[model samples]
Target: MARASRVAALAIAVLFLCGCGTVANLETGYRQGWKNAVIYGGVRRDVQSAGQWIDHSWTWGKDLDIIQDIGTVVGVGLVGIDIPLSAVGDTLTLPVTVPIAIYNNSTNRASVSRKTDAAPPAAAVPVNEK
Candidate 1:
């Protein structure tokens, strides 16, 4: 039992250290999980991507071999484990991440507005007479 527990812990640590969706979200301004107040955005995003992959595999990969099928199943299983883990990470760090996401959004909007405001209006083109 202790061995099993230790193995599980090590697996989780490896997954966490390998940079899952939560890490990617942090690096990308938390864009994946910022929509939800509870911060399940990262999981949702990961699921969507996984769903797309599965959908594409079924739709486009009509002749997958045994090895390919096994690989897909394993990939999906890993994602299954990753989704909840990412959700937990996002939830745990919500206090810090939410504020950072808000700041990034605000700054992005402000910069866009500034650029638009600074741009001059286009002048009318003159008509060419024969």
Candidate 2:
């Protein structure tokens, strides 16, 4: 009975080690999300600044980003892919995300420019005014 208990304990230990390794991938996904927040923020600004004449091209890029994020989360957190696969996925998806990030950034920049252009100039104060 003692031997059986020892064997069972060993089996449990081995299984725990194997299974828990994948759980770390959840952290990997979260870290990626935090790292990409700037890109997401630009996308948000694009959404907020969209003009009636603008066709909202950022929507497509935003959808792509969301799809990629969901895929990464599911792949790493739910499917329990290896930790290294997280890096592999990031590498593979860079090409996909980079353009979207750039597009979003440019959109935000243009929006800022338009706001600046539309702003009323400051009133000039008379030098002799008290």
Candidate 3:
């Protein structure tokens, strides 16, 4: 009876450890995926806005390569489980939230600047100000 109890306890412990490992892996993957998506979205918005800054005759093909490279780097990092996460119950959450917030801010700023530049100068300003 003693030996049987010890074996059962060891099995339960191993199962618990395995469960924790699985949760950790899932959480890390999810966070990394989210980060990659946010970064890529920001990069795309920035590239599009940059396109408007250049003359109509100029192309943005070369500039787009940089965005693609950023995406690749993010992809590699995610697949490698480079992003860490904290366990909360059964779910894993990102340990760092700053990157996502910064990316969102950058995207918003780029989009706003692009729209402002695209609008006619007179339309962008109030008639009373002029």
Candidate 4:
């Protein structure tokens, strides 16, 4: 019974830790976080970057060799497993993330408007009255 309880606890711990997207998004602030969450946290981004890197690697080129293809498949499979976990996390955290995103948006817009107002107007072009 004690061993079974320990196993259950470990499983719960792993589930929480596997939510890489939620952690990454929350750390980077709302705007970027929101974007990351939308794009499957960092799953899509990581895969794309990895593919590009492999394509450019000396051992690999635009055409993936069998070994490289298998590696890519494995990497994608791991990321695929994380996708649903991240989606769940992102959904659960929406209440928090949404407010932060709104606040960041408003503040950025206010700052930009202030800067525009502070700048001097452009020189007016001379015109002849008919």
Candidate with the greatest TM-score versus the true structure: 1
TM per model?
0.54, 0.29, 0.22, 0.52
* Candidate 2 lDDT by residue in tens digits, 7-120: 999866644443322223333434775234332232232233333113232245534765555544544442343333333433444555567567667877988888775667
**Any residue pairs clashing in model 2, and if so which?**
none
Better of 1 and 2 by lDDT: 1
Best by lDDT: 1
Report the lDDT tens digits of candidate 1 across residue range 1-130. 9999999999778557543766666655535554333345567667776776666555445467654676578558648777777877778768876776687678779888887746577888988999
* lDDT against true structure, model 1: 0.67
Comparison by lDDT, 1 against 3, better one: 1
> Per-residue lDDT for 86 in model 1?
80
Local distance difference test values of all predictions, in order: 0.67, 0.46, 0.45, 0.61
Error of 4 at 129 (Å): 26
Clashes of 1: 1
Tell how far residue 4 is off in model 2, in angstroms: 50
Selected candidate, larger TM-score, 2 vs 4: 4
Model 2: per-residue Cα lDDT at residue 29: 34
Instruction: After superposing candidate 2 on the true structure, give the runs of residues whose Cα lies further than 4 Å from its correct spot.
Output: 1-83, 117-130
What C-alpha RMSD separates each model from the true structure?
A: 11.3, 17.2, 17.0, 8.2
1-130 in candidate 3: lDDT tens per residue?
9999999998666545433323444445467864343322322333343344342424357667666655555544433332221122122223333455577578879888887745455655556753
lDDT of 4 by residue, 39-120 (tens): 3444444455446645544363556576676666655654666555666666666777677667767877988888774667
**Which regions of candidate 4 deviate over 4 angstroms?**
1-18, 30-70, 118-130
